[model samples]
Target: MAMIELPDDKPVRHPEYVYMDYARHLSGRLRRTITGPMWHGPSLREALDGINAADAVERPIRSMQTIWEIVLHVTARAERARLRMDGLALDEPTPEEDWPRIPIPCTAAAWEYSQAQMATAYRSMAVRVCEVMSSGFLKVVEKQSYNIATMSDGVAEHGAYHAGQIVLLRKEIHSRRPNGAHVTDLLW
Candidate 1:
């Protein structure tokens, strides 16, 4: 079979390479940071594990965001990164888009929907990161401070930051459970 070479796009990960390539490494890091087994602490998914709708909507601290709002914001950021991979000329997300208000009457079904949307968005962003060409990683989008590689790192960092927040909030809510019914078994 004749190997066809594309002039404009060279993949960062070559199948024959014994070691992992740049894009694959970045992709793995991004995935782990968002999804778990991270060395530093709980991943985003782990942080939200077992949280019900009431837990999701609880604001343990005054003026702090609910777990639901953080999930929505993370989803929005992930979606933004995915769209940028397709060369979308998107500007910074508006305040509403960044941290969308939680819907009134947030039911269990609605909370489930938010979680599903967040998972899908993060997965899509990771897929895009894994598919970037070597050159693509170096090419910065106009009006953006980070290149593809750094931007993807930012996604992981952003997720980790929010995950920490969620974990703390979860702890606060758990601590207040009646009759000393704290979540003593929480991994985080």
Candidate 2:
């Protein structure tokens, strides 16, 4: 067969609408999948397993959030969203505003407790996604502050972005571990 070389396309048109829908759908699923106990290892526990406690405490790859901080931050965000969605006034201030006020615990037991709380919060957020889908996609609820999102697209993107940070942090931690074996581990 003769090889044919095609010239580059004159210009690529952006499928902005299609891409937006895809982003909305994909983010929804990513949020749901990561919160569940799936075999593909998307759950919070799965993400936490095999990770050293000390390493997980280190700050995120790009953000100031440590893995522990990220867990707490995500949980708080979910809670705030739920409140706003439910027509409740958020007595709790925004994270950036309240972080200094909301003292982070320093003990091991406290860290574990916070992670568990986050897991519960994430599961609740997933349930809310189902509620919204059942009601209708992008149904504007007066309670939702007119700050609406399609099911979970907005929060999901935020979560997934942080999740990637978590994954990178894990790799860095493994590399720095005493064995330094994961520095060369195939799974890494």
What does candidate 2's lDDT look like per residue over 1-188, in tens digits? 22334476444434444444554454456455456434433455556656555656775356566777677776777666665556565555655743422235466776677767766666666566555443443546443434435435555555666666666677676766678745223342
Residues 1-188 of candidate 1: C-alpha lDDT, one tens digit per residue: 22345687653444423122667776777788667788899988888887889999999987779999999999899888888878887899999999998877989999989988888887777778766654376668656877887887788889899999999888888778785435542667
Write down the lDDT of every candidate, Cα atoms only: 0.80, 0.57
166 in model 2: Cα distance from truth in Å?
Answer: 0.7
Pairing residues by index, what is the TM-score of model 1?
0.84
What TM-score does prediction 2 earn?
Answer: 0.62
**TM-score for each candidate, following the candidate numbering:** 0.84, 0.62
Alpha-carbon error at 73 in model 2, in Å?
Answer: 1.1
Worst 10 contiguous positions by lDDT, candidate 1:
11-20
Please estimate how well model 1 matches the true structure, expressed as its whole-model Cα lDDT.
Answer: 0.80
Q: In model 2, which runs have C-alpha deviations exceeding 4 angstroms?
A: 1-33, 36-44, 60-63, 89-105, 132-151, 183-188
Question: Deviation in angstroms for 84 in model 2?
Answer: 1.4
Steric overlap count per candidate: 0, 0
